[model samples]
Target: MVSKVNDLDYFVAASEQEALILELNLIKRHHPRYNVRLKDDKTFPYLKIDLNEDWPRVHITRRLEEDGGRYFGPFASAKSVRQTLKLIKGIFPFRSCSKPITGTDTRACLDYDIGHCLAPCIGAVSQKEYAEVIKRVILFLEGKQERVVQQLKSKMNRAAEALDFERAVRLRDQIQAVEQVVEGQRIATTVKGEQDVIAFAGDKDQACVQVFFIRSGKLIGRESFLLQGTR
Candidate 1:
């Protein structure tokens, strides 16, 4: 490999994270013969929320497209992505149906009956109201639980002030759920802020890398990647 290479060039990055980004971007863009294995994105899935639709639904998608949709992750596996989706659904309980949203449907689906959806099909929630839910989902997925909690609290207070005790109670339940998850993830860490912990293992011809994304001393996500050209 060294004999085949004619020249070498490099760029300096401002930080270690920036350097890693540059390396991955270059590998993805150029698809170097030796590092081609690392460029494969099919090994993981991302959480996509297509903003193009009137009622955006959260789902797992392998491809990351630039279609104005908000994407959350390249999770380690489908199972992990599904687990996260389940948690989000339990808390937010937005609409998960595929039917066109005309807001004139006669009946709600089973998901709405089971408390898994807001049932926007029958005008259970207006678009503006549903957008608020999506905003919280995005914040929660971005590891901004504190912001979500604050927003929930504010909404709950407003609901209470409006004499809507039922809605306020539901918001209270959501707040407790979010707090429980956050508390369960709390642990000791030597690092002070957001940090990415990376580990590598390899043989002569191939290698694997594991990365843990930590925020506020909690592990937010994990991923592993395989690479070639170690020979």
Candidate 2:
């Protein structure tokens, strides 16, 4: 039998058979949502990339299925996720179109004209070469920071050797951006790698607390919250 006492629910069974009977009846009658089954409807947003396909594309989604693609993120903020994706699309330009890049008579989007996308939508980059660039992005997102930094350094060196100062400068800037992300991650986490801290205080009528963000051994920011009673 299950009963409520002091706002808490308690269940008691005298014997195994009785427990089984109680459980079966609970499942059949009350059918309490939590006791019936687990829900799979909610999920956090993630960035999905089809790296193995002929013409890869990056998409923002909330599903997790094994479709021979790569997935990243359970980012706390949609805006931050979008901004990071924009930054990546700017430098990497792996394809963002829905259609295959076959002989589609494609034209460059605004991203290309604004120097954000590499215009893979227009067949500017072949599948094999674009796959290589996507691989670099995957490595960078997978926390293989040194690998990406080394690869960018090599690219910058090659561009400099080939007397392409403009390309070399761009590569240098990309490397710096990657470094900045790593540094930011380090600063966002505590020494134990915990990202944020939360505290709360409350009474019958109201509640409030201040949250402090300690980044890289420094208190960087804080926020306070207040809650109201309904009745």
Candidate 3:
């Protein structure tokens, strides 16, 4: 039994399950207007990639399905997912435009000028080639990083063979970027396989859990969450 701090109201339960049942029954009986979330149907957002389309686009979404396109996560934070999407757009140059680029004569967006995109919006790259980039990005999101690294290595070697030193150097830098991500993963997950490291702190009233996701011996990302009340 637990007594209210400021009122004579009291609650009692035989066990954890009974406690939950009692709490739910109380909420339903009273139908308290102060509990906003109790009547809401909202859920956290996710990252969705529509690979089935001819021109795939990655977007932050709230929908969930077992579709063909890739889905990254039910991220703990919308800000983190947005930031990650930005980084992915920068590296992979996947199109972010909502409308189809077909038959449009407009110039490339600012992202193209800054090299953040491959300019698929204006025929700078073919749909087929852009699809290839999307494939690589999907592989990366799935933690099969070696695919991208190996492709970059081949390109670097070919550039070097043709005496295109500048291009070869550029490819080398991209390869290094991929390697850095891989190394970070290795340090985060010392184990040989995919595993998640989670740590929790706090007492009965409030608590937070930090989760680190390691895939293919790499530390890809981390998230944290706070829980209110005892469970």
Candidate 4:
């Protein structure tokens, strides 16, 4: 007889996203043979931006917690995850360092000099403005390409009207980045839900299951699995 899930120890997260992340970690660490398909080497990475923090720096992590931070992926690999991060950071100019944003620094760091960070440590960007930038980053990650594009267009127009051509050019680049990501996704549905569309192709001995992840009406990413003992 199979043991009941309720009879086993369990941990709860604040949301389904966190719970799913936890389940993946547990399956990975334990290597339960029952989850042969999921234990494959293609461990998807995540873009973790802790909005809960005052100076949220984006990170790529495989682990998740219930700390109220926004989780982006389960991406196919580190390379692709970094590509997405690059796009967002290039446009938003968030802090790349892990240092705490205590605002006590005497001068800007190398990241600030290199145009990689907004230098929140020295008040280069106000907290409210940084929060807005982070919001845009979140929107981009959430696959709301149209919304982000519109926001950028509005900002670009304002910059141009104010004779800030340099700012307008930057906004244009940001719009393009958002659109580039959107253009690549093959729309799977018009439904409203965070769900996976699973399909498989195989024979009696083995099979490969493809999972297309859709969130907020956009296809975010996908993972495929090769499995044993297919019926």
Candidate 5:
């Protein structure tokens, strides 16, 4: 049970459903003592790809809003999210900024110089090219490793044919990173149509609820929730 606080805040929603969602996101972020808790005493991290912006950037956040951006995760832990993000940045040169892209700058940022970003903001890379990188990242997060690898291989071949050996080498590295990062995640359920499948596992002290989204006979993504209460 949570102890009484000296101050409190209230939120207003137009409907009960909206109110419920607001409460859930709040509790998920705060993890109040009276609410379900996660391991490490921290909230899960969400992989937020802000699609609403002209130049999208992948951000890790705990809050979910009504914005048009796409989100993934409620991962097992924040650490896992960080690891996944490191792997993503290693392979995909997606921008990590929230600012609007303007190509007026004379020079690209350090991220572009180091090859962490494709520098769409500074006109070093076209929107179409940057979008292709983001697409590979989205595929990676969606657990479509084989598809991403094939796409990268095709892109590499095209770059090589164009005599862009540098770009071809980068694509080859991205393909290798995809293969190395995406490991064996076995299917836990029987064959079924498109659905959101959930499974739970834990002992008396804690519990974990893992939800797997499957479509077209493939696991698209997964979200995990941890509970501290006993059975």
Candidate 6:
């Protein structure tokens, strides 16, 4: 391969990290023959919260932009990301719709009818209240579910005390759901702290790497990367 080369090209960067980034970009663009290649390499999905909006909405995105909103997870798979979104939507009544929030919609959308949304579009929920919900969602995504559960428990107690039985019931259900998810997480490590467990497998032509993200001993998330050019 080296003997066949007619000429050489080079690039320089200000820092090692910058150089690595440039190298990755070049490899992605040109798919160099000798470079180890990722099979089906694509940008992983992220949960984006655009706070710039009048009512920030949490949804999935593949691109990371400088839109001044919080982004979470270059998660393993689209299916897992969507499942996480569904779980969050079930617990927090944030708006999933893209419709403008004028608070004047004549009718709430199906998301509202199905109890998946707070219907901010129709003024069913105040901006301040919706913001609080978004806060919990962010906390949940950050693997700070304990803090979120504490907040929910506090609110649930208050609602029950105030005789808002419906709201109290909703909060109770959310707390239970969070607890169930937490309990379902297996203890992937005995070290008693957060760490990633990585494993790799390969053949002559292909390889796969798996990562298990453990937080406080619990298996929180996992991702797999497939690679080619193993020979």
* Cα lDDT over the full model 2: 0.68
- Give stretches of model 3 more than 4 Å off: 1-39, 65-67, 103-106, 160-170, 188-190, 200-208, 225-231
In order of appearance, the predictions have TM-scores of 0.78, 0.63, 0.70, 0.68, 0.65, 0.77
CA RMSD of each candidate after superposition: 4.6, 9.2, 8.6, 5.2, 7.3, 4.9
| Error in Å for residue 82 of model 3 | 0.9
Give the better candidate number (3 or 5) by TM-score.
3
lDDT of 1 by residue, 108-176 (tens): 988888767888988998899899999999999988898999999999999999999988998999999
- The most accurate candidate by TM-score is 1
Model 1, stretches more than 4 Å misplaced?
9-32, 36-43, 189-191, 196-212, 223-231
What order do you get sorting by TM-score, best first? 1, 6, 3, 4, 5, 2
**Across residues 20-113, which tens digit of lDDT does each residue of candidate 6 receive?**
5466567778887787653236666889999999899999997667789998866667998899999898888898888778999899988888
Candidate 4's C-alpha runs over 4 A off are: 1-46, 61-68, 73-84, 100-115, 121-123, 188-199, 214-217, 229-231
| Decoy 6 TM-score against native | 0.77
Tell me the spans in candidate 2 whose CA falls farther than 4 Å from its real position.
1-32, 35-42, 103-106, 188-231
TM-score of 4: 0.68
| Candidate 4: residue 40 Cα off by (Å) | 16
Q: Candidate 2 vs candidate 5: which has greater TM-score?
A: 5
Assess each prediction's global lDDT (C-alpha) against the native. 0.85, 0.68, 0.74, 0.80, 0.77, 0.84
Candidate 2's TM-score: 0.63
Score residue 134 of candidate 1 by CA lDDT.
Answer: 92
Task: Choose 4 or 5, whichever is better by TM-score.
Answer: 4
lDDT score of residue 95 within candidate 6: 86
Best by lDDT: 1
Q: Taking the tens digit of each residue's C-alpha lDDT, what string does model 4 give over 102-199? A: 77788998877866677999877889978877888887776777888898899999999999998788778778867877877647576787888999
Residues 103-197, candidate 3, lDDT per residue (tens digit)? 35589888777665667667787888678778878877777878899987998899999999976885687678777777766774346876778
